[model samples]
Target: MRQLIIRAMATGTVATLALGACSSGSSDGSAKGRTPYIGVILPDTTSSARWETQDHPALEAAFKAKGVKYDIQNAQGDKAQFQAIADHMLKEGVNVLMIVDLDAASGIAVLTKAKQEGVATIDYDRLTLGGHADYYVSFDNVDVGELQGQGLVQCLQGQTKPIVAEVNGSPTDNNATLFAQGYDSVLGQLYNNGTFVKGPNQSTDNWDNATAGKNFTKMLAQTPNIGGVLVANDGMAQAVIAVLKQHHLNGKVPVTGQDATVPGLQSVLDGDQCMTVFKDSVKEAQAGADLAVNLAKGQTASAANAMVADTVTGKLVQSVELTPEAIVKSNVQDVIAAGAVTKAEVCTAQFAAACAANGIK
Candidate 1:
């Protein structure tokens, strides 16, 4: 839930993205004439829509441009299925296997198997805790959480003894852990300083929005004075907003979310959501492609690999960590202008006036 990705997370540039369109796929599903194959395993269709909606398409374009054959599939949150998919890809003799683990345990197994088969593995988006991988590709996850926490602090400007409820992402997700580290640093300080009150702080299982909504509703009931909410991603934030509306406390409470989803942005436009974090998908996909493509070319490592410290392993895995952006009413136009979203998409009939009002055109 890192609030739909802090409602983010996409990364980007026209020239960087253009690399994906540089080469076309070969007829034999190989990279040029290398007989290269790349396999990507996404955690689940439910955890984040970006897996299918953004990463898949972007990776496909990247691999196509490199003339590489690839197999990408979703695990559907099942460990068995993830193993099965990995088995198949291994049998395909893939040169690189990238995965977004559902949990560290399962991810470790998959990574271990890939290593045994002599395939280069990538820890994409979510890190496989304590697992060995060729590289990791994701955004500055802790910073993503920090943005949410900072945004929530701003939202609590007028409130007194504001009860700040935290709806974090799945505990098993590495990105979630980093996000928690970020928000906790910010909000925890506030709670200690008597600036904000700590209310219900819970992590969702599998980043389930339904569970997040229910948990948030119960928190509201127990802490009738909840003033602001820090939801890890846009999906859970949307759920929380629904519950807020039912209690007639929607816009009154400043809700911070991550993942600049369509609804998250609209919520910001309507003032129901205080802010969202934006990570460009294209940029993240580009990073993963760079690693995967290089591996397929038999290159071991590159200087572009980012140095990221893995707290659990006491080692820094070669990573490609991008930055996150804070999305608010003041700067939302940046998202539209960056081609992350379109005027046609955001300027709906109800939002058209608001879009123009916000200089979105």
Candidate 2:
């Protein structure tokens, strides 16, 4: 498998990153009377809905408003496509490069090349291990996972020895690793104490929904008593819910998700899912855009919210880490108030009465 080969070949060492003479002149804004260019690459559309609906628009708006040159594209989960995009951008000599890496190894290759060309680079949303990026902007991924674990525990409080299945994000993603760390910290104790049954826990392939569906179905088959499901994001949770529905356990089982997406929110209202962790994409997108623009202008992203310690390289990278909030039926309206999702999208005819009761509008 590609995973095995990459893991075996991963160096985990900082690639030689000497930003040669390709530096963008001064830190004021324009470089040599020319507007700076920022190149951004998102991982894929299937990983999450926010990539297309939220992040892309916000990023474009930010750059357009600032009157900067930018080229943003989704790699569509293909490393070759990702490489081509990066090559094209580099050929145009972009001043700053930002990426949501599909895999750490491939991402490292891009960042390494950018560094060699003296282009400022940022690890956006997902951290690409062993890459020399100037900064990282994302939600506190470990905390995001912790919230999921805690939410599952709270959702099954009264149940005695309830079985819980975990549908985690792709193992190749570093953020997914942090999330697992957070949630497992909460779920592991209960499972060890026999307070809850830890059923099958599987990681989806590249955060794919179909893979999650198959994993969830397999878990349910092995442990039919599963009453709580901890899913990494809304997309995979939707797939799990469908399988649950087939088994007539949709409303009865508690499922956790993130991304406060329309479908995820509707599931909470319909009692088909427990809660979703709402990491506002606007905040992340705007923060990433701000950082990228600063870097493009030959400035550092030190104004970022925090300094992230890279476990692999043992170096601190400038970072902006936003908090992720847990969204349940009780406070799902808050997501609407924050404008992460429109009332029109979640308050459909089928969910009309529930939306009204929950003050979604």
Candidate 3:
């Protein structure tokens, strides 16, 4: 899988095909008098702000640019709603279906049904562990975790034997597991060498920020000297930061996050968060859109250059694995330049000086 992903990155074929499709101007790709349509089911809006704020618009623009008929809906974190939306889309005669599954069970059920209906299925972000999908599009999630772990290590460079607590994402999300694996691989070395003390490690339910805050609070109470935190994403990081602030340890202890949301960037600028990982949603959306367009048009969808193993089935699934970047205070402006966040959103009155200091105009 790593070799395939490296080959794809080296060749850049996925980006070329996706970009070419958008500019081709051959809108109608239907066959047998059937109107080609794509259906997209998002997992939820709660886990990260990216689903609605980034992925949705990026996907809408991509589909519109290709002149494809499509429907995009969010399950709002409800498994039943996710299934209902998939059933309705299938009933409406969609030729391709893409999803960011809430869990393997719910996603497997939806993917299985779509396959039975003869529809092409793509796993958008979260890959269903046992489910079969024609293609999968997501960032290299383990790499994302490794970056977070490295960021926390960088932040605690001089601290001797600092306790590091981990606030991981939802247990049900496969990405979370992969993320933990990545970070633990890095942090484990420090723990083994006695350079860092391991503290409480817990996963939040549904990536809930409130639950994360509660979990971190309990962990802090149990071990009050936690010098660093390895949080899974920006939302949960924000929760952990809140707990740190309650104890007046906000900027004193370093925290790592992902998604590079406005709050996360602001936190980084203000020295509250040590770092974040930025995954280009526009690029991801375009890749998925390109695949759906090909499937909808009855054309042979270009095979993604990468592959990821299905942990449950032990089969490698074709995948479009995008690279992720780590963001620190020195490079916060890069995210704004990449169009992930606006300067105005991240550089409010409270953060104005920090923005200016970081060269963010």
Candidate 4:
């Protein structure tokens, strides 16, 4: 069983502080002398634009502000490239290594190697099921799914026995399972009581948008009555919306999404998508940087006040879990106010009127 240990703390932002005097050893757990260095490995760019547009810059800013030596790289969805990047980082002698694993097997290999080398490791954004990471940093993902579920339920109000289809993220990603767990808790009751009909559900490979489009297309073909969709993120939501447009059901069938990207927010404003969950990547990145900095300095990561049980290992891992917010058409401006997206990005000429109507200047 998976467990979550939570304690009361501010969830908005994590402060980045400069490093103090270095410890004896290098950041890579090497002989005493070299400065501490941190390494980060991102999963892919094709899954979502946030990997490059949001998380990369936020993490760079946080690390640069603290004068921390770090190398950040993306695997571009290739397992070999992911392993190669880790090998390079380890060879370069980083004190702390962080990763958003593409898959558990590859992640486990890298984390195990990092541990064998005596370097500290962190699972960032996406937790590796059984990886030997010292800490984990991410938003409460189950809450994200619950928000998507509740948002879908609200959007589906007044529909008679609506059929809901799920276009989930990659099957290999642990976050996808947690997300399904969350939304299913709410939607399952409706399915059991006959309040809603469950439609075709499938997981896309590596959260590919094109695969999501194909999966959703097949679902629509089999069950033309799919009343709502629970898409994992904005990229997949866009694909699902495109298919809905072909059937002239874009705005008619509500869709739930996450990551509050510019296009996702626009879809919500345009009434094409019902709602999206906003997770401030800056906050998540800052928390990760704080943890990495502490680990590099051979000190305890104070931000890891929470605990998450690794189901594969049955071990409780220290974590820093943040909160996520649900964003609908009515409150799209909140994402802009939080600086996750700019008004100009979401309020283009096509959506200008919608933005104005929603109180966005």
- Cα-based lDDT at residue 173, candidate 1: 82
The candidate that wins on TM-score is 3
- Estimate the TM-score of every prediction: 0.89, 0.90, 0.95, 0.93
Backbone clashes, each candidate: 24, 0, 1, 2
Model 2 Cα shift for residue 128 (angstroms): 0.6
Pick the winner on TM-score between candidates 2 and 4.
Answer: 4
Stretches of candidate 2 above 4 Å error? 1-34
Least accurate 10 contiguous residues by lDDT in model 4: 24-33
Model 1: lDDT to the true structure = 0.80
Model 3 lowest lDDT segment of ten: 1-10
| Model 4 Cα lDDT, one tens digit per residue, 1-361 | 3246564354433433233454423354322335668999998888888888789999999898878789999999999999999999999999889999999999999999999998889999998988968888888888889999999999999999999999999999989988888898889999999999999999999999999999899999999989999999999999999999999999999999999889999999999999999999988998898778777876545553577878888787878888899999889988888777798888889999999999996
Q: Tell me model 4's lDDT, rounded to 2 decimals.
A: 0.87
Q: lDDT per residue, candidate 3, 118-223, as tens digits?
A: 9999999888989999888888888998999999999999999999999999999989998898899899999999999999999999999989999999999999
Question: Candidate 1: which stretches are off by over 4 Å?
Answer: 1-34, 303-305
Q: Write the per-residue lDDT of candidate 1 for residues 295-344, one digit (tens) a residue.
A: 66565443243556556675667666678999998778877775566667
Between candidates 1 and 4, name the one with more favorable lDDT.
4
The better-scoring model by TM-score among 1 and 3 is: 3
